[model samples]
Target: MTTAEAETGDTLTEALTEVLSGARARGGLFHRAVLAPPWAVRVQDGAPLSLACMLRGDGWVLHPAAPQPVRIAPGDVVVLCGPTPYVLADDPATEPGLLIQPGDCCTTPDGTDMCEKLALGVRTWGRDADDPTVLLSGNYQLYGDLSTRLLDTLPPVLVLREGEWDAAVLPLVATEVVKDAPGQQLVLDRLLDLLLVSVLRAWFARPQAQPPAWYRAQSDPVVGVALRLLHEHPGHGWTVASLAAEAGVSRAGLARRFTGLVGEPPMTYLARRRIDLAARLLREPDATLASVARRVGYADGFALSTAFKRLRGMSPAAYRAEHGAR
Candidate 1:
C-alpha cells in the first residue's frame, strides 16, 4: 500500500474508534426489569437508541408502525432506534399498563408515578414478586446531531438471536446491575457501551447487511485517502488541490472519485464534518463560539455561524440551547 493508502486505513479505523468511544456512557440510563404476565410498557420516542435483552422467559416488542409484534426469546438482543415509539409486553395483545417517558420516568396511564411503587431492588424494577420474565434495558439519550451519521444508518428495529453474536458482556452487565458499590453507574454505563459496540460490529459483519455509504467508501483507494485527510484534520484549510496532492491524484480526479463514492464533493463533505465537530464542541458548557469555530477550521465565529445556519438551518447558539450536553 502507498503511504496515503496506509494513512487512510489508519485514519478510518481511528475515526470509527473515536465515534464509538465518544458516543458511550453520556448520561445513559439502565434498568433491570422483572415483569409478570399481563404487563406492557409503552416506550416513548426521541431516545436515540435503546437496547433490550431478555435474560429469562420470552417477550414481545410491539412497534405501532410494524405490521406485527416481534417476539424475543431468552438471550436475544434487540436494538430499537428512535424517534419512534414501541411497546414491550408479555404478549402482543396486552394493553400497556404503564408508559416509560423520556428520562426513564415511568407513569401510569392516569399520570400517577409508578417508579417507586414498583421498585424491586438496586437498579431493579418490576410489577410482581413472582414474575418470571426478566429483562435488561439501556437507553442512550444522545442529542440529535451528536452521532447522526451512525444513528441514521440503523433500522427502526434490529434483533440478534442467541449464539448469533458473542455478547459475553451481557452476563457481566447483568451481574453488575444489582451492585450498589461506588461508581456502579459508570461501570454499568461502560458495560452497556461494550455490549452495543459488540452487537453492532457483529451486525455489520453479516453478509446481507447493507452498510452505509460512508462506511463502504472507506474501501475506495482514491476516495478513502481524501476522506482520511478530511476526517483526520478538519481544522486544516484544505482545497481540492491540496487534497489531490495528498492522495497522489489530480484535483479533478479526486473530486470526481470522492463525489461518486461519498455522494458529495470533498469540500462539501469537509464542511459538513466541520459543522458536526463544532456541534459536539458546542455541547460543552464552557466552550465559546470563537473557540468552536477555530477548532473546526473557520476564520471566526461569524463564518462558522453562517455556514452552520445555511447547512443545518439553525445557528450554533440555538443548536446548543436545544441539544447541548445535559
Candidate 2:
C-alpha cells in the first residue's frame, strides 16, 4: 500500500474524513479537548478510547490503569481501553505493576507536582483498537485500530525508524502536532487521522513475510469481492452459490480460490462473520439470543447456541455473562 492506497476510499480529502469518521463513529466521541500544564488529562467518563499517531513530547507520560507508566516520546501513539484514568506525567518510573483506575491520583516520590500536560492527537472512545499503534522517525504513524486479526500478527508495536518512508510526510505532520494555536485541536485531530492511515500504508508497503491467508486473499478480485460483500452483509443468508455469483465465479472456482486464498471455503467465512456479528449482538444488552439467532440466519436460539459454542468454546449466555458490557 502506498500513500495513494491510504487515499483509496474516495477523493483524498473525503477518504481522510471517512477514516476520522469511522474511527470516531465506532469509538463514539471525538475528544478535541486540550490540556496544557497544571491539568492532568482524564478520560474517566468516556467509552474505551484510543490515541493514535499524535506524539507526546517532553513533560508527559501515560499512566494507564495498568501500574506501569508508559513513557511517551515524540512519535509514540498509545491506546487505552476502559474508562481507566491515564495521566500524562513528568515522571514515569513510579508504579511498576499495580492495576490503576480512573480517578486514581498519585504523586511523585518527592511530591514536586510532576506533570505538565501536552497536546496530543484526536482522542476518541469506544472504537476498535485493532487498527495500528506505531512510532516512526519521519513518516510515522503512532497509533491506529486496523482489525484484531491484523494486529495479532504484528509485534506489540511496529516502529519505522528512519528512511524515505519516514521522511516523506510524517515529520511535517509531527511538527504541526507540536504547535499550539486557537484551533490547534481541530488540526491535531486531522493530522492524527492521516498519521494512522500512513502507518497502515507503511505496514502494507513493507510486506509481512508470509502474510495471513485472509490478507493475501483480500487482494484477489474474486475473493476480495466476496469478502467485501460478506463484511457488508454479515446478516444475510449467504450461500456458496450466492457468493460465487456475487464474485462472478463458478461455485467450484469460488470455493477453490477462496480456500486457497482465504484458507477456508466461502461457507466458513460466512459462518465466522455470522457468529462474529452474533457475538457482538449478544453483547448488546437489549438483544436476546433468539433475536440474535434470527438476525444472523440461525433458525432458533438452540441452533445458534450449538454453533456458537462450537466456534467460541462457550455457550452464548455464558459468553455474554462473562463478557457483555451490561
Candidate 3:
C-alpha cells in the first residue's frame, strides 16, 4: 500500500473500531430536530425507515418510549423509532387518534395527555427533503422521506441532551430545514449527510467495530467501482470475466480482492443482489414473478423461485403477498 492508502486504512480501522464498540448502546449514529407545526404525515409499511432524533425547542427528551405520559416542551428533543405509533404533543391525553393526519393531535386512554401544541422534528437515512418547515406557530409535521442501506448499520434512536455542541449545529440545520429556500433541500440534505458522518465519528470515537463490508468499500477504489457497477446495473448479465475486465484486474486477482474486502466472491454477491432486486420487483403489485426473474437474470420462474427460497427463506409468491405494496 502507498503511504496515503496505508494511513487511510489505519485511520478507518481505528475509527470503526472505536465507533462500533458502542454498537449495543441506546445512542444512534444519526440524529435531527424539528421545530415545525403539526401537519399530517403517514409512512407506508416496508418503507425501510428510521428516526434518529427530534428536538422541539430548548430541553431534550431521549428515547421517547414510555408506559405513561411524558412531557415534551419547547426545546426538548425526543428520539424514537422501530415502527411504533408515537405522538408528540402538549397534552398526552390530547394525542391525535386514528385518521388524524400528521401535524395534528388526538386524545389518550385516561385523558391525562400532557402536550397541547405539536412540533415535528426528525433525522432520517436519506436526503430526499431539503428544508422541512418546523415553525411551531402554525400546524405542521416535518416529514422526511428517503431510503438508504446505511440504516441497517445504525442504532434505532439516540436523543442527546441539548448542550453547546448541539446548539451550534442542530438549530442551524433546523432553520435550513424550515426555510424552504432555493436549493435549500440540497443544502439541508448535505448538512444531514455531514451530521450522519459526525454521528458515525462519535460512535467510532467511543470504540465501534468496522461497519458492514459494503459501507467499508466506499473508501476502496477497486471494490467501490465494482459494487457501484453491480448496484447500478443489476439487470445486466454480469460475470466474473466481465467485471474483472471492467475493473482492470485479472479474474483471480479481482475475486481475491473482492472476497477479502466484501466477505464474498463477486458471483455470490451478484446472486444475492439479483435476489434482492427480484424481491423488490415482486413487491410491486403489477410485476409478474416470471418477468421479475427474467429481469434479474434467472432463466425461468421455477429457477428464480428455487434460488429465491434458498436465499431469502421464502418463495417469491409468498414474499409478494407478505411484502407487496397494497
Candidate 4:
C-alpha cells in the first residue's frame, strides 16, 4: 500500500477507537437463550443498544427499521442500535407470547411478570435446558452523551453473518454467559463490550457497511484532523481560519472540504460537538452551569443556556434534571 493509504488506515483505526471508547456496559443484561422451535420473544421496546449472536440452530430478527426479516444462522451476529421495539423468533410468522421490558424484565402482554418463571439457568433463559437453538444477547443500556453521539451514527439495526465478522469474542461470551462466578456481572459487562466493539469495528471496515459520512471522512487527513481538533478541544475558542491553519489548509479550502465530506460547515459541526460536551458535563451533579459553559467555550451560564436552549430545546438545568442529576 502507498504511504497515504497506510496513513488513512491508521486514522480510521484511531477514529473508530475514539468513538467506541465510551461503550461501557456497566451492569446491563447479558443472557444465553436456549430456545426450541415455534418460540418467539418480543422485546416490547428495548435498550439503546443490544447485541445478539446465534451460536446454534437459526432464527430471525424482525424490526420495522429493517426492510426484511433478517435470518440469523449459526455464527451470525446482529447489533440492534435503537430503543425501538423488535422481535427475535424461530420464524417471521410466529407471534410473540412473551414480552421483554426494560431492565431485562420478562412479562406477558397483560403485564404479568415472568422473569423467575422462565429461568432455565444462570443468565440463561427460555423454554428448556437442552433446547437446540442458542443465542447470546447483551443489552448495553448506554448512557452518557458521548455514547449517544456514537449511536446517532448507526442505523436501527446491523447484521454480520457468519464469516463476515471477527468472531474472536463469541466463544468467550458463550462460555461466560452460563457461569455464575463471583464478579461475573462485571466480567460479562467487559466481555460484552469487547464483543460489541469487535463486531462493529469489522462492520465499519466492510465495503457495504455504509458507515456515517463523518466516519467516512475520518479517512481524509485534512477533514479528519479538523474533526479531531473539534472533539478533543471543544473548550477551545475555534475559528474556521484557526482550524484551517492547524489542519495545514487555507480557510476556504478547509470549509469546502469539511462541508463536502462531513455534510456540514466546520463551525456548525463544532457548535454541535460543543453542545454535546456541555450536555454531558451538565449531568455531573457538581458541575455548575457556568463551569459547563466555560468547559465548552461559552462565555457564561447565560450564554451557554441561550445556545443550549436554542439547540437542545431546553435549559442546562432542565436537561440535567431530565437525564437525572448524576
Q: Pick by TM-score: which candidate is best?
A: 4
- What order do candidates take by lDDT, descending? 4, 1, 2, 3
Number of the candidate with higher lDDT, 2 or 4: 4
In candidate 4, what are the lDDT values of residues 1-326, reduced to their tens digit? 99989877877777778678757666667888888989898985558888888999999999999999999998899988767889999999999978988767888888998878879888888778888999888887645423545787778888888788888678878898889989998898888788878888888878877888888898788998898788778889999999999999999999999999998999888887788777767777789988888999999999999988887888878777767554
lDDT of 3: 0.50
lDDT of 1 at 247: 90
In candidate 1, list every pair of residues with a backbone clash.
none
Question: For each candidate, what is the lDDT?
Answer: 0.82, 0.51, 0.50, 0.83
So what's the TM-score on candidate 3?
A: 0.46
Query: Which 10 residues in a row give candidate 2 its minimum summed lDDT?
Result: 136-145
Q: What residue runs in model 3 are displaced by over 4 Å at the alpha carbon?
A: 1-151, 155-211
Candidate 1 per-residue C-alpha lDDT over 190-219 given as tens digits, one digit per residue, 9 for 90 to 100: 777888888887887678878677777887
* Candidate 1 weakest ten by summed lDDT: 143-152
C-alpha displacement of 242 in model 4, angstroms? 2.6
lDDT top scorer: 4
Give the Cα error of residue 181 in candidate 3, in Å.
28
**Whole-model lDDT, candidate 4?**
0.83
| Candidate 4 residue spans exceeding 4 A from truth | 245-253, 275-295, 300-326
